[model samples]
Target: MNITVFCSAYSLDDRYSVPAAEFARLLGSGGHTLVWGGSNAGLMGLLADEVKAAGGRLVGVLVELLAHKGYQGADELVMTADLAARKAELLARADAVVVLAGGLGTLDEVTEVVELRKHGLHDKPIVLLDTEGFYAGLRTQLERMEAEGFLPRPLAELVSFAGTPAEVFELLAAAS
Candidate 1:
């Protein structure tokens, strides 16, 4: 599967970085491709490096502004005009989307994908890798939205949560 991973471009926490590499390793070993922001920093870089070392295909989508920052040696690099275009391209090429521990940018990407799915733009599986409870608040908020009838359907129908990389793969296998 072409798994689009939304994660932080920068993080000081090993808690996030360690699992990011493990997830990449698993993806590579499983023969899955990785699609992510093209940057040689933080979890994004770590994941891409691990995937490449493990012999997996890496596809990076970055905007012109971000492209100058440097890439983590993606086998295929796609440059976009801006962030919106980058997001569009990422979504267009993904068979599935994975949300990892990240900050504001990651949140934006994940939320946009979820909203797109909600609006029937696509039916791709979206998995949240809640490493170290990073996404607990977001999960709770999603549930609250469903309980209040703000969502057209239950969030669970659109998103799956996995505490570990192994569980993420399990969910992906079942989804496939």
Candidate 2:
């Protein structure tokens, strides 16, 4: 599977980095490819390094601005004119999406994907890796949206929650 991972580009928290690397190892050893932001920093770098070391393919979609930062670890790098185009390319090739602990950028990516799914644009499964309960607040917000009838469908129908990397692989396998 080609799994697109949305995660932080600069978070020093081991609570997030450790699990993200483990998940990458799992994905790599399982013969899955990683599709993500092409940054060799923070969780993005950790995951990319693990995947490469484990012999899994890495595909990176980067905007022109960020690509200039250097140290991008992707077998194939796809450069886009802007962030929107970068995201579109990322989603276009992904079989599934796994959102790890991240900040505003990650939130933006996940929300856009969810909106696409809600509008029936795609049926790809989106998994939230709630490492250390990091996504608790977001989960609550999603629930509130569902309760308020703002969501087109139940939250469960749109996203899957996995607390561990093993569970993430299982969800991805099941999604495929």
Q: Highest lDDT, which number? A: 1
Kindly list the per-residue Cα lDDT of model 2 for residues 68-136, writing each as its tens digit: 753455788888999899899999999999999989999999999999999999999999999999899
How far does residue 80 in candidate 1 sit from its true spot (Å)?
0.4
- Model 1 spans > 4 angstroms off: none
Model 1: per-residue lDDT, tens digit, 1-176?
89999998885577888888889999998898999998888888888899998989999998888877657478889999989999999999999999998889999999999999999999999999999999999999999999999999788878999999999999988998
lDDT of 1: 0.90
Q: For each candidate, how many residue pairs have backbone atoms clashing (under 3 Å)?
A: 0, 0
Q: By TM-score, how accurate is candidate 1?
A: 0.97
TM-score of 2: 0.96
TM-score of each predicted structure versus truth:
0.97, 0.96
Residue 60's C-alpha lDDT in candidate 2? 84
lDDT (Cα, 0-100) at 31 in candidate 2: 91
Best by TM-score: 1
Error at 95, model 1, angstroms: 0.4
